[model samples]
Target: MKEQTLPIIDTDVHHSPDKKEVLAHMPKALAARGLALPGGNGFGNPHGVNRRDATPPGGGEACSDPAYTLEHHFVPNQIRYGILHPAGLLAAGVSADYRYAAALCSAYNDYMLESWLSFDPRYVGAILVAPNWPEAAAREIRRLGGRPEFREIIMTSASESPLGREQYWPIYEAACEMGLPVAVHPGAEGNGISNRPYAGMPSSYFEWHTSLSQNYMGQIASLAIEGVFNQFPELKFVAIEGGIAWLPHLLWRLDKNWKALRELTPWLTEPPSELIRRHVRLTTQPIEEPEKPEHLLQIFDMIHAEETLMFSSDYPHWDGDDPRFVLPRKLDEAARKRIFYDNAAELYGLPPQESTVSEEAANSATPTN
Candidate 1:
């Protein structure tokens, strides 16, 4: 956010653990059953899962090693803090055996703690819990949620039922009690436990990928209509890997619908959009780049970008946006600082050293032509 490089707090960097790595931590019985990452239940992903370029030079997959990730992302990019999202293995959200699901999630969290969080001061984790088993998930959250290394609780965005349903309340309760935000990421689609993209399964990966925002839209609406914000006033939710452009449209539709249907959800005493503004935040990745760059700024303004949006590189993934170039080059300083650093800093409870930016430097920087 400064004329000089500002420290970035990336909210949606992904870490894809190999099956063997995770299974090595699980019980033999569980390991024998076998597991694959979240991109598919069994069906092959028609499209590749990550960028070839993102694979570490040392080679495994993108995000396989803390050392490789540091060399590739944090050290070179001037990132002060990164929230590690391990969404790939969260297919546990679809596991039939709640015990197995719980075990897998717990083991994965342990692996993340030892392998990533403990290994690096700059990196923090989102405790992945299987929402399919709310009680066990809550236990998992309570178990690991208090650790300084884990700043949030994460679950698959595409779940068997809309996340706002009463059954998921336990998980939300645990996050709120621990004072950690809930980050729902879009992946693991069509995996029995999670819904496929809207209007039944799409025929192609492209269609499936493009419709991810619809899933977030449904989740946001469900949470708002069901009074989740009212029920858990302290809860904060972040929609990860979902681009920010759709937010204004969603809020607009929600407000109009709520005015007409307020009687349907009396508990949502205020407008649905208002609740979303107060309680929800979104990550910027897979950003919806427009033909005209200036139009991007208008969308941000419409969505109150400073208050609601945060930047995420979605690192090691093909679509990862470079911090230097991802945002509009001529963005005003205040908007740039909040999107790149401050919003995520406050949301994730980052220390002042990582969260604070030099606003004077940003303000004084020469404007781009």
Candidate 2:
């Protein structure tokens, strides 16, 4: 690829790692308590360390090689999806053991702010945090907010407490104060968040993928049902890598539940959908596969949320699709401009356009007559 072939602000590129880069930052005392990462700890989640964990490479070896970076996967495909990644992938990639999932996550945010975001500010990040360890997570958020490039916080759905519980309040409060959105994508962690239910039902990748956002749905609904959202009005939550097709349904179910159970939570002042409509937005990537009939675009319109759908390319993943292929056929020019470009621009504080002109876009589209 050459200078022009940049991806659209792909909010889901997989790695920007530095193992020793972060392990070294921790004091010997803390480092000793934990093993470094990129090994067994982070096994098979979406952004698992190294493309294939069975064949793990050191941070330097992994990131130095094109196969492990966004450029290798995205550039050749002729897609203009700029990379976005959870800070945890970097932490796990940089450390040999998972001991410092939280710390390495912090270090990677620093590296990204100083490096990747500067690699081009249009480049954005989803800094990882462990909500189970709210104080630790809060510390990282405060540290990261100081940097302009580290725009949001990323966490696994696997928190120690259910998201609706008050225990996670610090995480919510810190995010609200920092003026950053929390990017919650469903993925794995040794303990932070888990998709597996270990129930009687047999599980498949599709099953887990569907449930990923369910975890958030639980949290958000709980937060609203339990009145957490009422207290933290400023919080803006972004769902990563998940398509929004299921959201309208989730909102409908939530609204129905509130009508049935509103009396249980005395503190809540407004309807559940109002909270959802105001504070949450979702990325429109891996967009439920086929872009269908014209009415598909109006699904959110029914819920009064046409503007909340942002776009993301789950970059570097084998299944991550090209933006040209993902964009809906009926998406108006304005919606296309936002989903393909502007929504993310506003979300991550990116400029209207970057210096790179998306050579991939230029090459892929035939010249207009």
Candidate 3:
């Protein structure tokens, strides 16, 4: 019997809006207050932001041009639906002025709807909400959360404090009330705005990237300890671009400590590991590639990949994974179906859509990372 094919539903495709497009959405008054759009923000990324070759033929940054992106990724990869994780704009989460940050997020969402979602039915927008001001963020979610294109609330993973704090609970409450999942994608670390590592900033980019799991670990632990899962049982979180290998270690430590320290926090109704498995979902980009396939499989087993893992391409980034080969070869057809399509489809409540890309069209366009 022939193996079954699945329609790819990518959860973590990044798209940076053209500066002009973002500016068009920004109010002239707010634009003057340093609502820096996309590439205009002065923060330097030493390795540059995207894959150099991904620049659209129309003359803009990678993932900026929706038409080129469709030709390069969605068509070739047969991605029927994608969650647009807006790049660069998420730094608003750590902005100095809460009002300015909120405005920037609103502008970014408008830009996404105009420049990306309106262009294709396959694309969905993330409502960028600055968590620094929880009430404002909640207001934004209330305003736009009901839209069909704006399906999820996107916030930067890097923040002044752990996301589980009561101050941030309003954002999650709004998300739950609106019936959307909260996606916390990774961003720059050690930049003086985000939560810092226990040891302080790493000396090199390689060290910084390698230690990103620390950020996720800290946030997840905070959520568990603060009883976020207990407070909002229906809420779901998607952690994108953070590798999954550290999950097992974090879970093990959380359970071990909870057993001895259960009295300190009486709110936890279940083990932290169990809560994570039930409430959290992780993306598989920058997957923990081990020397041996067995080692990778071991990591998956420990984390219960089938229950939590979802497919993410991180498209147009230098380290983006391709849907065609991101999964380990050892995964059976059922696991592949769950990761690449079913998990995300169910999580986002996306309706099944027929594949519109023909084999000839998919083959005619070359694939880009």
Give each model's whole-structure lDDT: 0.80, 0.59, 0.80
User: Among all windows of ten consecutive residues in candidate 2, which has the lowest summed lDDT?
Assistant: 360-369
**Model 2, global lDDT:** 0.59
Candidate 1 lDDT for residue 353: 41
lDDT of 1 by residue, 30-148 (tens): 88887744455344345566767667777787677776676667756767778988746767787667778888888888887767776666777889888889999999889988899
List TM-score per model, in order. Answer: 0.91, 0.76, 0.91
- Error (Å) of candidate 3 at residue 115 is 2.4
lDDT digits (tens) for residues 58-138 of candidate 3: 777788877788787877677777899876778788776777778878877777766677776678788999888999999
Per-residue lDDT, model 2, residue 180, is 85
lDDT, candidate 2, at 173: 88
Model 3 scores worst on lDDT over the 10 consecutive residues at 35-44
Q: Clash pairs of candidate 1?
A: none
Collision count for each candidate, in order: 0, 21, 0
Off by over 4 Å in 1: 1-4, 36-47, 353-369
TM-score of 1: 0.91
